[model samples]
Target: MLKGLARIWFCWSFPTMLKGLARIWFSRLTPNSIDTFKELSAQFASYFIRGYKYKKSTTCLISIKQWEDEVLRSYIAHFNKEALLIDEADNKILVAAFTNGLWKDKFLFSLYKNDPKTMADVLYRATKYMNADDALLAHEEKPKKRER
Candidate 1:
């Protein structure tokens, strides 16, 4: 997606490609903590590509409480924005790695060619993780049994 944007960089005429990338990557979130973390990972990578277009975002990264809010869900549904929005407060932050769309290979390859180090930086950030003391979580969330 960003590859598409980069291809059009010379023409300077396609904010839509950027929007497409944002929506594709942003909507993959599930309104859960881990998903939010993953979104952060993706967005950080996109910071280079998206640049100042998202200037009104109050925070560089979103906090967890913002993910749990219902108003955010409603806005995404309303706009038919392929990306998820947490609310009118601008709580959600979408990142490129978290975005699901495929980049046109030529553009991405050109990106790699122009700046190998930048691509490396993006990859390293996406793959890094915090070693917090939080318990290892199970893959499934089971429903609690009803008490008699």
Candidate 2:
């Protein structure tokens, strides 16, 4: 009975851990197709293992541009997501790719004026900008006082 309950717990929690395309793929599987945790693991591994073998190159980061009118926080979030998938990504290369993808904005100017040598430096600077952006957004979102 404990083993059954454990299986039920794992089956319930497993899908919640998936993200993006993997989540979608898991959701679309036919009902009863995965009766056991082993079956589910095998199916998931077989489907995704092929893609795992081909890790995305750093060059992919070069293509992730900040869209027009997109907020700094959004762009940074998107960039970091892709950056995480890369294996042994070079700091210099990541810094260059991140800089190249920026739209003409305050952050771009900042990057140009004080170039970051490493990905850590870039992320640190971006964190400050992201905070500033969030603060500005919060300020804008506050209800203004009504004129008497």
Candidate 3:
């Protein structure tokens, strides 16, 4: 389905292409999109927990919880955009990644960009684990099980 759309999009003229892409991608701020984002975030969280045994994985583990939270918050904020100063290119990349279901690839590529230090720095900067004294977690009530 997406491949066919991608092929068609590839053949579109520049003006039409931007318009089509904007309508298809940036307009997805619905509940389904939120759920999809959450699922994608959990998938990334699981990646850090997979015991990949690589130095990068270990570094990610150090701030895994915070990173996941920030990612979710940032994504949602991008959708809402009340007053946050988010980068347009970053948002476009995010929307494109979400539209294509390439969450992991897009996220890691955006943050890390093939630089291990950059990845570590961004993670560290956003992480709260280092400041345990100021860290507080919201207690979310679990969703009730559906009656059969």
Candidate 4:
């Protein structure tokens, strides 16, 4: 059963799932979209906090895949159920951010989550402090320099 689910999750349909998630992220947070910033921020904060609280403890930095996988697995173990408190949009955003291979030195909880405002502040700080490679377009690969 797990193998079947894995096969489906890793199949060609995965891209579609990512795309759908992206749409949700954009629609919820983008200016002039349906949801207000406060509403979207609240929704995002809800998930971000849950994910952070449930984040695995580690002395060393781990890959984004490891971070997310650990969080999901931990959720399943603790709750004895599937699906985390976070929505797919939050999951995709975190996965997309981490999968880009930037910010491997930092954990997801590095961002503040005391409240929605602090959380937004952390996100703002991230945009200003993190390198473009770390914060920008997850799907677009940075061009590699040619060796001399």
Ranking by TM-score: 2, 4, 3, 1
Most lDDT-accurate candidate: 2
Weakest 10 consecutive residues, lDDT, candidate 2?
Answer: 47-56
Off by over 4 Å in 4: 1-117, 132-148
Runs with alpha carbons beyond 4 Å of true place in candidate 3? 1-14, 19-119, 129-135, 140-148
Give the per-residue lDDT digits (tens) of candidate 2, residues 53-101. Answer: 3358988998999999887778889999998888899999999988899
lDDT per residue, candidate 3, 1-148, as tens digits? 2467775564454225344324443344353443343564574456446733222221222222223335543543343332122222243333333323223534446544533243234435334332432343333445689999
Model 3 RMSD in Å is 19.9
What TM-score, over all chains together, does every model reach? Answer: 0.16, 0.62, 0.16, 0.18
Per-residue error (Å), model 1, residue 53: 21
All candidates' lDDT scores?
0.37, 0.85, 0.38, 0.41
- Predicted candidate 1 versus true structure: per-residue lDDT over 53-76, tens digit per residue: 332232322222222343323422
Off by over 4 Å in 1: 1-80, 84-95, 98-100, 114-148
Q: Considering lDDT, which of the candidate structures 3 and 4 is the better prediction for this target?
A: 4
| C-alpha positional error of residue 88 in candidate 4 after TM-score superposition, expressed in Å | 18
Question: What ranking of all candidate models by lDDT puts the best one first?
Answer: 2, 4, 3, 1
Q: Which residue pairs in candidate 1 have backbone atoms (N, alpha carbon, C) closer than 3 angstroms, thus clashing?
A: 1-103, 25-99, 42-95, 42-96, 43-95, 72-86, 72-87
